[model samples]
Target: MNLVLMPMWLLSGSVFPASEAAGWMRVVIAINPLSWPTDALRGSVLGEPAGVFAWAGAAAF
Candidate 1:
């Protein structure tokens, strides 16, 4: 995404300073840690934290 942004910034007569750009990238990454296997979980019809609940169920029995 930053690669995409770079060309636009060059054309726009403006640029995010290097330090600010890196900080923006870090914020984007931090929003999605991916520490949990949340694939297709939040938007699925099940509409619950299925990954966590499924793990708990497997451990319970």
Candidate 2:
């Protein structure tokens, strides 16, 4: 599972949040399933803006 999720994790900006990454990387992270949950969780815990669209994307999947 870890191996299977590795690409998503790396692309999701978990190690280096989008803010510090390149524009292309941010674009990739935006579409990564891993990023959605990570962003949502961060938003909830930090009271920041959540990745609302992530729920829709998850639903689609």
Candidate 3:
């Protein structure tokens, strides 16, 4: 489940807590512990299908 989202700051200054509200979003990498780009798994093209967030598995389809 790859996500291609622009940085919240760019979309809306409210994304952050305190800022000038410039509203400049960018494509930032958002990864969970289970699926992240890590050096430990160098040279690997696979990742665990899970989320590291504590409440990530609250529900399932």
Candidate 4:
């Protein structure tokens, strides 16, 4: 499980800046279900703008 999920975590835009990540990495992050909640929490706590998609995705989840 660690082996399988570690890569997903790495590619989930959690460890690195999504904008600076490679194109493929960004694509992976975009589809990652974890990103929405992470983004929402980050936005709420940090007063950052979590995109509409993030809210919608989190709501959908």
Cα TM-score per model: 0.21, 0.72, 0.14, 0.74
Best model number under TM-score: 4
Model 2 spans with C-alpha error above 4 angstroms: 1-4, 57-61
Q: What residue runs in model 1 are displaced by over 4 Å at the alpha carbon?
A: 15-61
Clash count for each candidate, listed in order shown: 0, 0, 3, 0
Tens digit of per-residue lDDT, candidate 4, span 1-61: 9987788778766687789988877888989887787788789989999999889888987
Across 1-61, the per-residue lDDT of candidate 1 in tens digits comes to 9886555434321233223446655454333323112323332545755465444433443
Pairs of residues at least 3 apart in sequence or in different chains that clash in candidate 3: 7-26, 10-24, 10-25
- lDDT per residue, candidate 2, 1-61, as tens digits? 9887888878876688789988888888887877877776677779887765865654555
* Winner on TM-score (1 vs 3): 1
Residue pair clashes in candidate 1: none
lDDT per residue (tens digit) for residues 1-61 in model 3: 1242343222322244223333332222132222232312221334434343322422220
1 or 4, greater by lDDT:
4
**Candidate 1 — number of clashing residue pairs?**
0
Query: Which segments of model 3 are wrong by more than 4 Å?
Result: 1-3, 6-10, 17-61
How far in Å is the alpha carbon of 18 misplaced in model 4? 0.3
lDDT of each: 0.39, 0.76, 0.28, 0.82
Model 4 steric clash pairs: none
Which 10 consecutive residues of model 3 have the lowest summed lDDT?
26-35
